[model samples]
Target: MTSELIAALRARLGDERVSTAESVREQHSHGEGHHAPSMPAAVVFAQSTDDVAQTLALCNAHRVPLAAFGAGTSLEGHVNPPEGGISLDLSRMTELLSVNPQDMDCRVQAGITRQALNQILRDTGLFFPVDPGGEATIGGMCATRASGTAAVRYGTIRENVLGLTAVLADGRVMRTGGRVRKSATGYDLTHLLIGSEGTLGVITEIQLRLHPIPETIAAAVVQFETLSDAVATAIDILQFGVPIGRLELLDEVQMDASIRYSGLTGLRALPTLFLEFVGGPEAVREQIAVVEAIVSDRGGLGFDWHTDPDQRAALWRARHHAYWACLAYRPGYSAMTTDAIVPISVLAELVAGVKEDIAESGLTAPIVGHVGDGNFHTIILVPPTPEGLAQAWALDRKIVRRALALGGSCSGEHGIGLGKREFMADEHDPVALEVMRGFKKTMDPNGILNPGKML
Candidate 1:
C-alpha cells in the first residue's frame, strides 16, 4: 500500500518531487517539541498550490494521513506525523507573488519565512511585524496564530492576515476574504484556518497586512530588585498610555542564564524589563521619559536605552535567545516552555504566585513575557528521565489550571497543538468545544488532515 501511494504521487508530481528516502521521511516526521519520535513513510516536496492540491487529493483517496511541514519550529508537536503517512513539505514553495504598497499588503506563498519576507521588503519601506522568536514560515505562523514581544502593539498573525488560499480536506481549492479589508461577510473561514494547526485545511498562499517602518525607535533595559517590582512597573507604564512598542520582562534566573550563555557583561542578575518605543523623535522621547519615571519610582536601577540599529538588534537578539539560554543552564536537557496571559491588574500577583510555585517545586524555570500584553512564558528545563519528565508535565498542568482560574488562557502565542489538547475542554466550555469539533468534522470528515492535532 505504501509503495502504491508513492507510485501515485510520483505519477502526479514526477520522481523529482516525491521521495521515500529514510532521511527525508525522518526529517519531516517531527518538529521541535517534546513529543516522542515518529517517522512518516514518505515525504513530498511541494512547489506550488497545484502541487499541494494534487498531493492532498492522492492522500485523501488512499486514506493516508497528511501533514504540512514548515520550518519544524513548532513547540507543541503540531507538525509531528504519528500515523506514518506522507509529509507535504512547503519549504520549496518560497516565493513572493506580489507586493501592493498602496494597499499596505502583500501576497506570498505559504513557505516564506518572516525574516525572508522582511529582507525582501527592506527597500519597500513596509514590513511584517509578527515575530514568533524563532524564524518560522508564514503558513506555520498563521496556523499557530503566533505572536511575540511585538504583538502587544502590532497584534498577532490572526490580526495581520488579510486573506488566504487553502486546500480543504476533500481536495477543494478555496479562497477566503480579499485584498480589500473589513468584511462583515458570513462565516469567517479565513480566521477558522488561522489556528487550526492544519487539521481542517492546508494553507497554500497568504495575504498579509504590513506596517510602515517607524521613523524613530529606542530600546531600554531596566533592572529591578524584585520580580513584583518589574511587573508593577510594566503595568504602570501600560496604564499611563506610554505607547510602548515592546515591553518584555525577564526574571533574575533568566538574566543569569542569558548573561552566562552570552558572556561579557557587567550586568547584575536581577529581574529586568526590556522595552522599546517607536514613533516620531518627539513622541518617542516623551514615551521614554514617562517609562523612565515609572521604572525609577518602582526601584529600578540604571535604565539604559539604545537607538542605533545594530545596538537595538543586539539587545533583541539576546532577548530572543532567552529560551536557548535557559536550556543551556541545565546541560543535556530540553525545555518545555508554558505560556499564559492575564489582565494587567492581576499580572503582578500571578507572576509572584508563579515564582512561589517554581521555588516550591524546586524547578529550574526562568520567567519572560511580553508584559505590555499581560502575557508571559516559563521556560522549564527537564532532564531526559522519566521522573524529571513526569514532574515537568505536572508543573505545566498546574500552571495552566492556575491561569484558567485567573481568567487567562493556557497559551498566549503558542497554539493548542499536541500538548494542550486535553486542556481545551477545561479552557473553553463544553459547548464551545463541541462547536470546534463540529467545524472540524464539517471541514475534514475523514480526519486525514493532520490527524491527532488540535481537536
Candidate 2:
C-alpha cells in the first residue's frame, strides 16, 4: 500500500518532489522539541497547492496519513508523522501572490517564513509582526496559533492571518475569510484551523494583515532583585496601558545562559525584564518614564534604556536565541521545553512555584517567557540516560499541572501535539473534547490527515 502511494505521489509531483531516502526521511521526522522522532515512509516536497491537493487525494485514497512539514521549528512534535505515511514539505511553495499596501494586507503562499515575508515587505513600510523567534513558516505558525515578543502589541498569528486557502483531507480545496477586516459570518472556519495543529487540513496560502512601522521604537533592560519584582513591574506597566511593543522575562539562569551564548553584554544576570516601548518619540519617552517609576517602586535595579536601533536589535536577538542559549548552558543534554501560560495576576505565583519545584528536583532548567502575556517557557535539560529523561519529564508535567490548577493552559502558543495531549482531559471538559472529536471525524473520517496528534 505504501509503495503504491509513493508511486502515485511521485507520478503526480514528479520524481524530484518525492523522496524515500533515509536522510530525507530523517529530516522530516521531528522538529526542535523533545518528542521522539518518527520518520515518515516518504516525503513529498510540494511546490504548489495543486501538488498538495493531489498528494492528499492519493493519501486519502490509500488511507495513508499526511503530515504538513514546514520549517520544522514546531516544538510540540506537530510536524512529526507518528503514524508514518507521507510528509508534505511546503517550503518550495513560497510565492508572494499579491500585496495591497493600501489595505495593509498581502497574499502569499503558506511556505514562506515570517522573516522572509517581512523582508519582501520591507520596502512597503509595513510588516507582519507575529515573530515566534524561529524562522517558522507562515502555515505552521497558523497551525499552532504562534505568538512571540511583539504579540503583546501587534497580536498573534491568529489575528494577523485574515484568510487562508486550505486543502481538506479528501483533497478538496477551500478558502476561508477574505481581505476584509471584520465579518459577522457563520462558523469561523478560519479561526477553527488557526490552532488545529495539523489534525484538520493543510493550509496552502495565507492572506495576512500587516502593521505600519512604528515611528520610533526603543528597548530597555531592567534587572530585578527577585522574580516577583520583575513580574510585578511588568503586570503594573500593562495595567497602566504603557503600550509596550514587547516585554520578556528571563530568570537569572536564562539570563546567564543568554549572556554566555550571545556574548558582549554588561548585563548583571539577575532576573531581568526585556522591554520595548513603541510610539512617537515623545510618547515613547513618556511611556518609559512611567515604566521607570513602576520598576523603581517594584525594586527593579539597573534600569537601562537604549534608543539606538542596533542596541535594541542586539537585546532582542539574545532573547530570540533563548532556546539555543539554554541548550548551550548544559552541553550534551536534551531539553524538554514547557509552554505553560497563566493569568497575569497569577503569573508571579506560577513562576515562583515552578522555580521552587525546579530547585527541589535539582534540575537545570532555565526559564524565559513573554511575560507581558503571562506566557513562559522552561527548558528542562536532561542527560541522555533513562533516569535523567524520566526526571525531566516529571518536572515538565509538574509545571503543566500547576499552570492548569491556576486557571491557565498547559500550552500557550505551542499546540497540543504529542507532548501536551495528556493534559487535554484536565484542561477541557469531556463535552468540549467530544465536540472536537466530532469535528475531526467530520473533516477526516479516514484519519488520514496528520494522525496521532491533538485529538
Candidate 3:
C-alpha cells in the first residue's frame, strides 16, 4: 500500500516532487519544538493549489492521513504527524498572486514567508507587520494565529488576514472573504480557519491586509530595578493609550543571557522594557515623553532612545535571539517555554508569583513578554533527559494553572499542538470546545487531515 501510494503520487507530480528518502522524511517529521519527531511514509512537495487538491483527493480516497507543512518554524508541534502518513510540503507554492495598493491588501500563495512577503512589498509603500521572529510561512502563521513584536499596534494574523483559498479534506476548494474590506458575509468562515492549525483544511492562498511604513520610528530601552517596576510601566503605557508599536519585557536572567549571547553593549543585566514608538516625528516625541515620565514615576532607569535603524535593530537583537541565548547560557540543558497571558490588572501580581514559583522550583526559567498585551513566556531550563522533560512540564502546568486562575489563557499566541492539548479543556468553555470539534468533524470527517491534533 505504501509503494502504491508513492507510485500514484509520482505519476501525478513526477518523481522530482515526490520523496520517500529518509532525509526528506526527517525534514518533514516535526516542527521546531520539544515534541518527539515522527516521520511520515512519504513527503509530497506541492507546487500549486491544483497539486494540493489532487493530492488530498487521492489521500482522502485511500484513507491516508495528510499533514500540511510550510516553513517548519512553528513553536508547537503544528507540523508533527504523530499518526505518520503523508506530509504535504507547501514551501514551493510561493508565488505572489496579486496586490491591490488601493485597498492596502495583497494575495500570495500560502508558502510565502513573512520576511519574503515584506521584501516583495518593500517598494509598494506598504508592508506586512506580522513578524513572529523566525521565517514562518504566512500559511503557518494563519494556521496558528501568530503574533509578534508589532502586535501591540498592527494586531495579529487574525486581524490582518483578509481572506484565503483552502482545500478541504475531500479535495474541495473554498474561498472565504475577499479584497473588499467589510462584508456581511455568511458565518465568517474566514476567521474560522485562521487558527484551525491544519485540522480542518490546508490553506493554499492568503489575502492579507498591509500597513503603511511608519513615517518615523524610534525604540527605547529602559532598565528597571525590579520585575514589578518593569511590568508596572508596561501596564501604564497600555492604559495611557500611547499606541506603542512594540512593548517587550525581559527579566534579569533573560537579560543576562541575551546580553552575553547577542554581544549587547553597555546595558546592565537588569529587568528591562524594550519599547518602540511609531508615528509622525512630533507624535513619536510626545509618546516617548509620556512613556519616559511613566518609567521615571515607576523608578525605572532613564529611557534611552535610539532612532538609527541599525541601532534599533541592535537593541532588539537580544530579545529576538532569546531562545538561543538561553540555551547558550545553560549548556547541556533544554528549555521548555510556557505561554501564559493574563489581565493587565493582574499582570504584576501574576509575574511576581511566577518569579516566586520559579525560585521555589529551583529551576532557571527566564521570563520575557509582549507586556503591552498582557502576554508573557517563561523558558524552564532543565537537563535534556527524561526526568528533565517531566520536571519542565510540571512547572509549565503550574504556571498555566496560575494564569487560568487569574482569568488568563494557557496559550496567548502558540496554538494547542501536542504540548498544550491537555489544557484545552480548562482554557475554553466546554460548549466552545464542542462546537470546535463539531466543525472539525464536519470539515474532515474521515480524520485524515492532520489527525490527533487540536481536538
What number of backbone clashes does candidate 1 have, counting pairs of residues 3 or more apart or in separate chains? 0
lDDT of 1 at 326: 85
Please give me the total number of clashing residue pairs in predicted model 2.
Answer: 0
Task: Write candidate 1's Cα lDDT for 191-244 as tens digits.
Answer: 999998999999999999999999999998888888888999999999998888
**99-193 in candidate 2: lDDT tens per residue?**
99999999999899989998999999999999998889999999999999999998888889889899999999999999999899888899999
Pairs of residues clashing in candidate 3: none
TM-scores across all candidates?
0.98, 0.99, 0.98
Evaluation by lDDT, superior candidate among 2 and 3? 2
Model 1 residue 9 CA deviation (Å) reads 0.4
Question: Which ranges of candidate 3 are over 4 A from the true structure?
Answer: none
| Candidate 3 overall lDDT versus native | 0.90
lDDT of 1: 0.89
Question: Can you write out model 3's per-residue Cα lDDT over 1-455, one digit (the tens) per residue?
Answer: 66687888899989999999999999999887888999999999998999999999888888999899999888778889998889999999898999889889999999999889989999999999988867889999999999988899999999998889999999999999998778896899899999999999999999999989999999999998999999999999999999999999999999999999999888889999999999999999999999999999999988799799999888776688898899999999987788899999999989999998998888899998789889988988877888877877788889999999999998889888888898899877899999998999899999999998877
Q: Model 2: which ten-residue window has the lowest total lDDT?
A: 261-270
Q: Which ten residues in a row have the lowest lDDT in candidate 1?
A: 259-268
Let me know the TM-score candidate 3 reaches against the reference structure. 0.98
| Residue pairs in clash, model 2 | none
